[model samples]
Structure formats: structure tokens, C-alpha cells
Target: MKKLVKLMVFIIALYIFLEINNQWLVVTEHVLESEKIPSSFNNYRITQVTDLHDATFGDNQQKLIEKVRATNPDAIFITGDLIDSNRYDLENSLHAVEAFVKIADVYYVLGNHEVAINKMDEIYIALIELGVHVLPNESLVLERDGERLAIVGIEDPLMGMETEEMLNIALANVPDDMFTLLLSHRPERFDTYVAKDVDLVFSGHAHGGQVRLPFIGGLVAPGQGMFPKYTAGTFTENDTTMVVSRGLGNSIVPYRLFNLPEIVVMELKSK
Candidate 1:
């Protein structure tokens, strides 16, 4: 009887700990240096928020906003999955974006969830009204000290378009010598980004494999399957570097094990 009681207590304790871990926000900072990065843009900080799935972090997303504001980012990027398709709630997710736009220019690209919701027009209009740049297979230039840097964003492949074709369209006019930063929702397409010769990329979709394990990393991801690579952190292939956010919130898998929600703060350095 005592052993059974102890077992119940242990299960309850583990549940509480995992719940806390889920809501506990952690900032992962990365300093990316590349000779291609313009000297004028050096030390430019960017805060990335991904895979929110409409999960609340403090009232009105104050906790997430405060954390991003604390980073003092020059730009804020929302890679994808701001809201969950399973439970559509754009207003709830926008609470963070409302605060984020006030802190810095917010750039966003669609994720699989958003595409599945089939309300791209509504979502785009809402974000645009809030002063967010909604990039749909397009490129925008950020000029600093008369030096040009391209920021390219593409639609999620779920929109019935192949990622390679999308990249080709987005990069059609971008100069070969230009330093390009691509915002893509799927990290599984890292090879495609590298093939396009993109200098840097920001992506999130794996959700840190939904459940992480020590040494083995993310246990499972949507695209990468079991023990997938590109679940989190920085992955480099040749000259292209990709930073994948572990992301915030949960969807189908209601709990995250040993995987704390994360906000990636990246600073660019001209090497």
C-alpha cells in the first residue's frame, strides 16, 4: 500500500514539474558571424518567436513580450505556427505580436498551422494592420549605412507549393553577392536553403521534437520523424547557417518533456 501511494505521489510530482517546464521561458542566444554580413549591420539583434500555438504566457502575453523586449532586438521574427490549427485563436496569439511590434519591427511568415486554418487573407490583414510585414514568397531589403541586406520569406510548403520552387521565386531577383536572410517555417528544408545560397535562415516547425531527451535531442518532429536533426539550435551546411527555434507552446502533444519553451535571440556580427 505504501509503495502504491509513493508511486502516485511521484507521478503527480513529475506532472507538476513538466507543466512548469512547459511554461518556463528560456532565452537561447546565438552570435552569428559572417564576412558577408555588412559591418553596419553588425551587432544587430533579432528576437525570434515561433510555434506559439496560441498558448498564453502570462496575461496578454506580457511574459513573452517582456522577454523579447528585454533582448532589445532590432527586429522581431515570427517564423510560423503562431496559432494552432487544431484550436484557432489568432486574437490570443496576436497579443504578443501587438506588444512585439511596439518593441521592434515584426516580420512574419506563414506556418503549416496557419495554412491549414485557410484564413491567410484574414491573418495577413490583421498583422498588416498591426504594422507587421507579412512576407509571402517575397523579398525585402533592409539597408544600413547604404549597404543592402535582403530578408526573404516564403510560404509554408503545405500551401501546395514545393519549397524549392518557392525559394526560386523568392530569390529570382536577389543578387548573387547579396547577403540574404531567409525566414522559413520548415527546418527540414535546410538543404534547399543551402542550395539557394542563402547566407542565414531562421526556421521553426519541429517544436524541439515535442519531447526532448538527453544527448539524443528531440525525440520526434513532424517532418523529421523520430530522433530528427534540425530540431533546435544552429545548423550549418557550407556557407548557409540556419537557426531553428525550439519554439513556445504545444499542440497535439499536450506536454513537453525536458524541453523548456524557448525564444531565440540572435546577434549578427560582421566577420
Candidate 2:
């Protein structure tokens, strides 16, 4: 009995150590069947980082950034939760922004936390200053090697900022031959994007339930109840593909088991 107890203690200690030190980078490549995707864009890479929740400059974040940079993505998308609260250290947000800016073309959308903290404008301005494009009910045409793609960003729906009319207006000028990508903070309203014929949607808000359970998936997600459908990874509705990142950080709950911090790299392919 004594030996068994000692072994169990040793194993527990090791598990904790690994959790602190085990920085993992999960890569997911997605293929969207879009008529607008040019043949030349057979494999355009897009890296996604979401729900950071102020986990910056730490070993996990550093490792995640390094891994993302290594992927050599054509563009990077941050789906929100960049800051935990306006009360927490703003420096962490700066750090997180700087890290991504150094790698690829960074784009972002606001999350509920930003609105909850009532610092959305401040955070938006700061991120824009760092050369990160803040896409809130806005659209930008991405031109690379003579190929044009439309990228749209919508504000947080839960915050009551998302407008279907605004989204349509943003895409009004986009030609039918151009591929469209939408960045939203929540995955709950995927149907709206699908109706608009959006080729891909990237989001992260559930934090993969913050603490995923074994075999059964996530236990609970904020705003979303137990076993949230869009907790982490990919979900498809019609022709639209939605990639919900597990995110790099945590909030309300600080520990992750089974679910590790994720940095998604989606490679867009032409059909």
C-alpha cells in the first residue's frame, strides 16, 4: 500500500509538470469547396489563433507563436478573447499582438470580453496601431499575386453588434468570382454566414469547454451549455466550413486537461 501510494504521488507530480511544460501546437488543414477559389490558390494557408484570454509571454504562448510562425501561413486570424478583462494587465494584449504581427498578415474581430470590459474601442485602436486589421462589420480585399479574395469581419453577435444587413453591405462589392471568408467571434450564428454563401468562417469562444473530459468531449462552455456543439475544431453547415479554435488560453477556469491550447492552420483549397 505504501509503495502504491508513493507511485501515485510521483505520477501526479509528473502530470502537473507536463501540463505546465507541455506546450502543444495543433495544426488543422481545411479544404473548402469554393467556386471562387482560384486554381492557383490550391493551398493558401491561413493560421487561426483565438480565445487567447491574456495568456501571453508564458511558455505555452511562446511555444504556440513559434509553432504558428513556423507554419508560414499566408494570413493569420484572431477570433477574440485577446484580453481577459480591462482590469488585467493590458501589456499581455500588447505582447500577444506583437507576437502574431511578427509572423503573418494579422486580422482580428472583437469578442464579448472586450465589450464586457467596456474597452473595446481602446483595444481595437491599440491592435490597429500594431498593424493588425480590426474587421468589425467590415470587409477588405486581399490581393496576392493578382488573385483577389474578400475577407469580412463581424462584431460579436452576443453583444448585439452583428447586423446581417451590414454583413451584406460589406460583401456588396465583392464579385462572384472572389472567395469570401468571414471572421466571427461566436459559432452559434453560423447559419447566417451559410445563407450569405460565405466559403469559410473562423471563430473561437467556447475555449473547448475550458476543461475537456475524456471520450465525452468538453464538459461546459460559457454561453453554451454542456457538451457545446462548437467547442473546438471544425463544423460544417451546407457549403460553409466553420473552424472553431480551442484557443491558447483560459478564463474563469485556469486548467486544461485532455484539451490543449491550439493554433489552427487552415489551408484553403480550390475545388
Candidate 3:
């Protein structure tokens, strides 16, 4: 009985520690050897945030913003799942958008949750109104220091009606000799992008398995299901690279174990 009581106390203490320190901003840097990137565009900083899910950001967000500001990111990208639920609440989404707007030039794509909540239109408009560039199956070119980089955002295939056609259009304008960054919510569609020879893809739909196992990896992932392929972190296929964020908040299940919430900062380097 005494041993049992001691074990229980140990478990409780461990849980508290994980929850309080769950907020971690992971910074990952990668370099792509593409003919398109201008020689001067070698050290571009791209900050990425995914799966906020309307949970309390705690100090993670503020610290992330400060870090990005310090890095002087060339641009910011949010993959999806900004809200935790389908039901729209103005306060939470708005607050998230406002906070990101103050940090850097923001661009976004919708996640499955955004569609499930049936508030994509309103959320899209709200984000744009707040000076965020909403890229729904579209592409934009950023010119700095007389050099150009192609940034493309694709809609979730599950929700967007003309996802395939839109992807074609978005890629049509990308020059053969330019570095291309594709923003997608689901990492499963990597094959499609690889066929098009995209340089890098960013995604966040899997919450790093939600409940990760010690050495076995993620136990469950939404959409992808058990033993999900792209739960969190970085994956590469052929020459195309994908970074799946563990995400910043929880949904469906309110608690997280092993998998802590994260905001990803990726610096693009030239090789």
C-alpha cells in the first residue's frame, strides 16, 4: 500500500511538470540547393505556426513572437487549425490573428478543422482584414533585394472544391529556376507536390500523435489514424522536404502527454 501511494504521487508530479512546461517553440533550419533562390536570398528566415486550436497560448506565443522579431523573418506561414472547434467565436480567433500580425508578414492556409467548423469564409475574411495574406490555392511572389522567391498556398483537398485545378494554377506561374515553398495542411499529399518538383512543403494536421509513446512513436493521429506517417517534425521524400508541426493547442482531447505544444521557426539556408 505504501509503494502504491508513492507511485501515484510520482505520476501526479510528472503530469504537472509536463503541463506547465508544455509550451516549447522549436526552431528548425534547412537549406535547399535550388537554382531559383537568388544568391542573396541564402539566409531567409521563415517562421511557421500550426494547429493553435484556440487553447491558451501561455507564454509560448509571446516568446515565439519575440524570437521571430529578433530573427527578422522574411515571412511567416500558418498551415492550419487556428481554432479548436467548428463553432465560431470571434474573440479567440481574432486574438490569435492580431498577435501574429504584429510579429511579421503573415500568410495562411485552412486546415480540416477550419472547414469542419464551417467558418472558413468568415475566418478567411477576418484574417485578411487584419493585414494577413490568405492564400487559398494561390501563389504569391516576394521580391527583396532585387531577388524573387515563390510562395504558394494550397487549400485543403478535403474541403476545397477545385483543389487539383487550383494547385495546377498555383504552380503554373512558378518559374522553373525559382525556389518554391508550398503551404499545405495535410502532409499526405506530398506525392502530388513531389511530382511537380516543389522545393519545400510545410504542414500541420497531425498533433504529433496527440499521445506519443516512449519509443513506439505517435499512438494516434487525426485523419491519418493509428501510427500516422507525418505526426510532427520533419520528413523528406525524393528531394522535396516536409515539416509537420506538432501544433500549439489540443483538440478533441484536452490533455497532451509526451507531445508538447510547439511553434516552429524554420530558417531557409542556401547550400
Best by lDDT: 1
Which has the higher TM-score value, candidate number 1 or candidate number 2? 1
- Each model's total of backbone clashes: 0, 0, 3
Candidate 1: where is the Cα deviation over 4 Å? Answer: 1-8
**TM-score for each of the candidates:** 0.97, 0.87, 0.87
Which tens-of-lDDT digit does each residue in 152-231 have in candidate 2? Answer: 98887656645576577667877765788888888877778788878888988888876677777888887778888888
Q: lDDT tens digits, residues 1-102, model 3?
A: 999999999999987877754665455555455555676777777878788787655444466556556656777898988876644455665665676787
Cα RMSDs, all models: 1.3, 2.9, 2.8
**Number of colliding residue pairs in model 2:** 0
Worst 10 residues of 3 by lDDT: 56-65
- How do all the candidates rank in terms of TM-score, highest first? 1, 2, 3
lDDT of each: 0.93, 0.79, 0.77
Model 3 accuracy (lDDT, Cα): 0.77
TM-score attained by model 3: 0.87
Error of 2 at 244 (Å): 0.9
Q: What's the lDDT for residue 100 in model 3?
A: 70
lDDT of 1 at 256: 89
Give the alpha carbon lDDT tens digit for every residue of 1-271 in model 1. Answer: 9999999999999988988879999999999998888999999998999999999999999999999999999999999899999999999999999999999999999999999989888899999999999999999999988998999999999999999999999998899998998999999999999988999999999999988888889999998898999899999999999999999989999888889999999999998
